[model samples]
Target: MSSPSREAILASASRLFGDRGYRSVTVRDIASDAGVSAALVMKLFGSKEKLFAAAQPDERLLGELNVPREEIGAALAFRVLMRREREMQEPWAMLPFTVQDSPDPEATRAEAREKYLGHIAALIGDTTPNRRHAAVVVSLMIGFGEAVRTLGLFDDWDFDEVVAHYGALVQAQIDACPVA
Candidate 1:
């Protein structure tokens, strides 16, 4: 059989990592899951770390939102909830470890954190007043994603319910803040 293309490999890897944590999976496992040879996996992605980075959905999420300043909060919450639901359908919840055992894990995590903060800042529109609150809101969203995955909440709950819950909470925060 012809070797699977790099795109195919990356797609498989993304699903696998999103379903199963990156640490628990092996290249051979990914190859078997993708119906390709281990050699092909190695050739396509230099290492597991590189493969994880390549498979990450961060860029995709950003692209989906276009980083619109006004609608960023709702857009981010919607996208995050959608991603969580999608990931929950898989056999495992592939939550990327912000902190890896790499030499520069702190730097990597800091960059990721900053990316998230920037998105929130665009949404809230007041760096001084909303920066910390936005971070809290994002963190809460991440926690909610994990909880939904862990409890299989999406199996019974609908998207509207999820959106309503998050929307109300976010709006409450915005309303509480003094208008500048």
Candidate 2:
């Protein structure tokens, strides 16, 4: 069984990491935010790297994209919107931070590419490796998330209408993926 302090520490870690990326935030910061001690955080998570790894789960949300190709774009759109509503943020929003703000830019970029974007590209493609098209779809998702959640651009827009319109835009890119 987990104690409330442990859960609070974890929640603080996730929020700090999500906001400041990997390198900038530290155990002390997370501890302060969680109202715990640095020693406790170190004892619990071992290290900042371990804390980061634990903070970001395998992004099961991406699994929803594994639908039929024809419905993939819509699925991506709907899933991202759902995630924004539920999680207040998406992995794509952290891409730039995970790379540019990290100590090891190349490794971070490659890992994120493989873990998040690569999975997205593979799901969006049949057999041809549709990386370019997937990039645009991810870009759309990131932009939509930023606009709707951060800037409140589409507050009054009907949910279904936003889904259909953005889903169509994402679908156009999915349809452009060429088969090998």
Best by TM-score: 2
Error of 2 at 107 (Å): 0.3
- Give all TM-scores, in the order shown: 0.75, 0.82
* Tens digits of per-residue lDDT for model 2, 84-160: 66774466565566577666688877887777667767786635444677777777877776676557687788877
Residues 1-180 of candidate 1 have per-residue lDDT tens digits of 334477677778777666566777788888888788889889878887888777666454554446444344465557657766565222112333534532357887787677766765555654664476767766666665556665656557677776676666665655454444
- For model 2, give the 10-residue run with minimal summed lDDT: 122-131
Off by over 4 Å in 2: 1-3, 126-130
Question: Over the full model, what C-alpha lDDT does candidate 1 score relative to the true structure?
Answer: 0.62
| lDDT of candidate 1 at residue 18, scale 0 to 100 | 64
RMSD of 2: 2.6
| Cα error of candidate 2 at position 153, Å | 3.0
lDDT of candidate model 2 versus the reference: 0.73
Candidate 1 stretches with Cα past 4 Å from truth are 1-4, 63-74, 84-96, 100-103, 177-180
